[model samples]
Target chain A: MSPGSGPHTAERRGRPRDSGTDSAIIETVLRLMEEGATIGALSIERIARETGVGKATVYRRWSGKDALLVDVMKSLEETAPPLKGESVRNDLVSCLEFARRRGLAKRSSAVLRNVLGQIHSNPGLWGQYQETVIATRREAMHEVLRRGVHTGEIRPGVDLDLLSDLFTGPLLARAVLRPDGSLEEGLQEGLSEQIVDTVLAGVAPPPVAGG
Target chain B: MSPGSGPHTAERRGRPRDSGTDSAIIETVLRLMEEGATIGALSIERIARETGVGKATVYRRWSGKDALLVDVMKSLEETAPPLKGESVRNDLVSCLEFARRRGLAKRSSAVLRNVLGQIHSNPGLWGQYQETVIATRREAMHEVLRRGVHTGEIRPGVDLDLLSDLFTGPLLARAVLRPDGSLEEGLQEGLSEQIVDTVLAGVAPPPVAGG
Candidate 1:
């Protein structure tokens, strides 16, 4: 059965179906991911069995494994509520806290590690990852940085791309490279503030004398 | 034939054997790595065959694939000479330049990417990589940061660990995550200096008034 044709046929005919099955499949995918299933190993049949849903239902929702995984990642992003802070520092800390919490979460870290392991070999997944994960987070960071620049909290002409990398790279490295290292605890607590402080020290304009 | 028991028995008993075979094997490993052979796929048998040497010879010098791959990484480190500069800023720039050059080198980046892709699954390799790659480079950065604090170039009491990550993490993320991205050329030229400058701006002590 083609995507959206099985369980959603009733919805197409005028009855709106509940979205629980959709979320259940994504949750199952995340759980399977935490249990060490990689993109290359994930199949609709397996997901269907694990989620206790019919294969036709899964097919009716996601076109394939790639689309399912993409939706799963997108759902992960949605878990972190939008960053809302009055100042750049507050916004950065909030954004970083979201990242830190996600990194420290057991399932999130496992899923991330699995993706990092296979991303090089999977271009379609990587493209989706870039779009859903990297680009979305980058846009949030860009907004914070631009606000900082406008308010004169950050220096003008700063390379936002490099600056964004500077801000997020350390945390990412910790999460990806040292997945089992002791630094994970450190990152979970105060490291985000330290990163923001240090980055701001560089990007923030010099303090006005006696003002 | 056992390792070192056949081809190098006479040399083991008498005069020192030429180091040519050692370098040849490493060179071939680098070449094969560039060709996309991972450490798991790079067996002594393959190295011996490709380098026109006996398995005993390859085994004699290195106990197994793990030791050989470790040595290959170690040799790459040796290519970038130790960082020495009169000041912390200069030292940082010099160190980053070394990394940039290595990242941009034809075979080096591919070898690194291959290692990164497989390192998490292979503890032996991951241990060796931590020691030979991460630890060595980190020590250099530590020295520079320490000297920067000592000379009042950098702010005292900075978290050197996180700061070190900030320095190298961006380049690493670019190399590993965006392997074929166009940012490579940008990295090879001025990005290193830019990183150093931005980081130093964050870490540098306030300028002394009229001094």
Candidate 2:
């Protein structure tokens, strides 16, 4: 079956489906969620119809609706751009801004809540989802914060884990609590700035060497 | 037929049922959740049988499982005592201690996650839940932080709302994440100290405040 160094080897015998099949499926799921199709309401048939893929293909890759949605969410967890500036304030602003820009989409929040709901009932999925998004995000921020501490920009005694949670908690709470399923944009930024200012006041200790 | 200040009254006619009814129903729901009844598995019949109350009586008070569970959760919300202490740290320690104790219960986290799942789907109940418990707890903490700021113990610019959320977020994330469904005891004191120290460092302006 090995064709010699040609596009022919990549091509399959079936009618050529786009190589972007995975992206298409994720997009379809996101689009469906954006349009208010909840996780409980989503079905493979609907996704297949939306993406123009056959049911058999989706089943082959993902066992069911929960699996498909989980994968779609995982795909969104690509490395968020790194913190932009050297200062703690700038780093936090960048972090919050990233959350604001990427985290607050109505569709994403709904899907997140729906997925969270599923996790409560399904133990197998909980660890994977938590590890992929929640833990991964925290780990990245922890690294950035540790760097800040090492550079004498942050105080020595701060609990990096607790501080990181404190930094992001309000935004997450508001997103989770609101029934309209929209993050109040102005509120998010304002709250982010407030938290940053507060933490900076506490964490950046007295000058040590390079004054 | 209203009683005219007599020993026998219409209110007393069903007084026996009314007196023990709420407690009996709540106990049933709590037992089910403790026994690992998924939110979907809770039923009026189950409660009726457990409480030995007629199904009609259960329906009369609570429209369905959602309403019944909501009422049951409301009863538990009374567990978080109001913040009362001489200082912000004292108040927060007390408040967080409440969460720590609650988190330590074998069934507490599961019960909470189940309620959260219900909250995500049921908007009315969600609002009610937040208004009764989440909002109350945060507001009390906000008052504590606000006092701290006024007394110049906390920085003037501290975002009280966001700070409260920061204090609570990790506890919540941990509550949902842990399979054992309780917080490790050390984390309670450790996180409390971390939050107080972090916030104080920021809010206590330098001898000559930095730009």
Candidate maximizing lDDT: 1
Candidate 1: clashing pairs of residues: A4-A60, A202-B202
Write down the TM-score of every candidate: 0.75, 0.77
DockQ values of all predictions: 0.36, 0.36
Q: CA lDDT of each candidate?
A: 0.75, 0.67
Cα lDDT tens digits, model 2, B75-194, are 676556755657777887777777667766755555565665565456577777777767787777788888888776776765566677667766665665444443675545576566
Off by over 4 Å in 1: A1-75, A106-120, A186-188, A208-211, B1-68, B116-120, B186-188, B207-211
Model 1 per-residue lDDT tens digits across residues A86-202 = 878989988887877677776666555545545544567777777777777788889989999999989999888888888887887787667665446644478888899998988
lDDT of 2 at B187: 47
Best by TM-score: 2
Q: For model 2, what TM-score does chain A reach?
A: 0.77
Reference-based TM-score, model 2: 0.77
Interface RMSD of 2: 3.5
What is candidate 2's CA lDDT for residue B162?
A: 67
